[model samples]
Target: MKRHARITLLLFFGLWIGSPEGWAQTTESGFVPLLNGSSLEGWEGDPTYWRIENGTLVGEVTPTTLLKTNTFLIWQQQQPADFELKGIFRITKDGNSGINYRSERVPEVPYALKGYQADIDGQNKYTGQNYEERGRTTLAYRGQQTRIQPFTQGNVRELVKNNAWTMLTVEKSLGEAEALQSRIKTEDWNEFHLIVKGNRLQHFINGVLMSDVTDLDTVNGKKAGLLGVQVHVGPPMKVEYRNLRLKTL
Candidate 1:
């Protein structure tokens, strides 16, 4: 009887320690979905430009016959300091689309008119790179020539894909601008990750280090307002976004 009781006590202690650690590990490592798979519960934007259809967030350009206005699908949940954002996006037409971060809120102006933009283009002319707001040109691709020459006019034409999903990422440290990473393959799914620390930024595409620019000039100080999706007005176009998630550091 004494031996059996001792064995039972030992087993109980072992299970208690082991089971709690396993449960705790799962909880800590679990990923919370930013988009709830049905509607834009935590997002705010113009209805004419952004909407959720079939679990994908769609940003559509109005018809050319309609009036033109700069509209954005802005994240209602704002992040100020360091954070990492990942998303899967696809452009249906050959046009412009971008993920805007560290942006300030202007009453009617375009969201990116204030912050740094991680630009992706479906047109085959510009490189997928970093472009500062209505300010001086920062880091850009070295070997390739942009379609819109002079680089500051903000005409991007590289890494743009039609009917394909493209992974994009941007990391911004306080008072520093992040660097541009490599171009992932289009027509299939890819992964992108970014890390931002004080005055230092790193970009990764498919587990490869693409850009590691540091000591960037301050554009909008340490903290900014919101994250936004861009739908440049011109010819009619549609862009779909999914798996959008953010982690605050």
Candidate 2:
């Protein structure tokens, strides 16, 4: 090839290799941002509660604006299946919210989601837990390695002995809840990480592995769905999120 032609090809691949979007789509841990930091582009939610303030995605509720149900601000760009998500969160003393992945939106309720949620709260008791928004609820608490076993009777799904759809067999493999809680920063921003690969999911906060789950429930396993942020309905609360990034595997 000619010298100029080789130079042009080199520049083209160099740009592609360094591009964030291109890298995120093809490389592990190459993050592509979900929040633009200045505006609410590529997201949908109830403007009454969700907004961007000071370059952060803020969800606030007042006593007068109490919500009847949990609401979500959903991402419109992608419905990720196997991926890693990262963000920074800050919450008030009363705040309760989470990042829901592989979740389906509720048709009856606006800005509602029902699926896997990496739970977050200011109390540190709930943060880093694996929760299903409207499904099995608490699949795994903080500091646990849980195994979900689901049994079926012929074509019908059989409930577990407790009448629950799946039997939760938990192994306290992770560190103590208090130890994981120590990594959390209340009323201040903390790093959050979530990984979902096939029927396995993991949650981490401030570099601590909070929970891990091996989902054996074939009847209710989520392969791919919407991604959303939650704002629970309760006392006056506020939660701020920033640096939303994702890397698909």
Candidate 3:
């Protein structure tokens, strides 16, 4: 009888030790949907400029309602430290938009984001790059694996920007920026992938590596902030995003 009791206790302990805490373990590592197909309950933005239509998050800039500055639709739920974000996006001609992570909400600008942005343009020109909004524009360009070094000049914190802000050199070039041009579907949906961990950031489009940036600037860099979607300031255009998913690690 004592032996049987011992066996039962052992079995109980084994089950307890082997069991998972919650459904997070038993299920596959599924990505959480940030944008619900029906409503924009957890998001904040300008109603006239942003809305949900046919299950997609849509942003539009019309001729009469031209924007003076770039604006964003921010996710109010959470601010992820290390994560992977992905979605399907398609923009019209001259339309430009971005996925901004670790970004600060500018109350003065009202829906403007000020931090690292994953840039994409309608002309397929600036797609797949790390851009610092209002801090340092164009931290890394397409097909670039870059590292930023402090500029030695007194009180000058960042590396110099020659006329344009594309001075950061590429450490490893997986492919050229032009290589991704043909790969991006102009009028159709294109997949965007962004991964951020520690001080490293990488951007990909349509399964191709676009740019990588290693941010060592601690004082100016952001460790945690909100995620946002951009509708750039320019001519009238429309952009749509769907199937937005995020996974934190």
CA deviation > 4 Å runs, candidate 2: 1-29, 153-166
**What tens digits encode model 1's per-residue C-alpha lDDT throughout 7-124?**
8866755422222212111111323456776887887777777778866788887564332654567787766467776666666446566676666666566443455556655542
Q: Order the candidates by lDDT, highest first — what do you get?
A: 2, 3, 1
**Displacement of the residue 5 alpha carbon in candidate 2, Å:** 32
How close to the true structure is residue 158 of candidate 1, measured as C-alpha lDDT?
35
lDDT of each: 0.52, 0.83, 0.80
Task: Show where candidate 3 strays beyond 4 Å.
Answer: 1-28, 150-169
TM-score-best of 1 and 2: 2
Worst 10 residues of 2 by lDDT: 18-27
TM-score of 1: 0.63
Write the number of the candidate with greater lDDT, choosing between 1 and 3: 3
What's the lDDT for candidate 1? 0.52
TM-score of every candidate relative to the true structure: 0.63, 0.83, 0.83
**Which candidate wins on lDDT?**
2
TM-score of candidate 3 to 2 decimals: 0.83
1-249: candidate 2 lDDT, tens digit per residue: 999998887675543232222221122247887977688899999888989876678999988889989999999999999999987788898989999999998888988999999998888779998888777777888888999877454432243223233567986679877777898988877888898999999998988899999898887768899999989988889998877889999
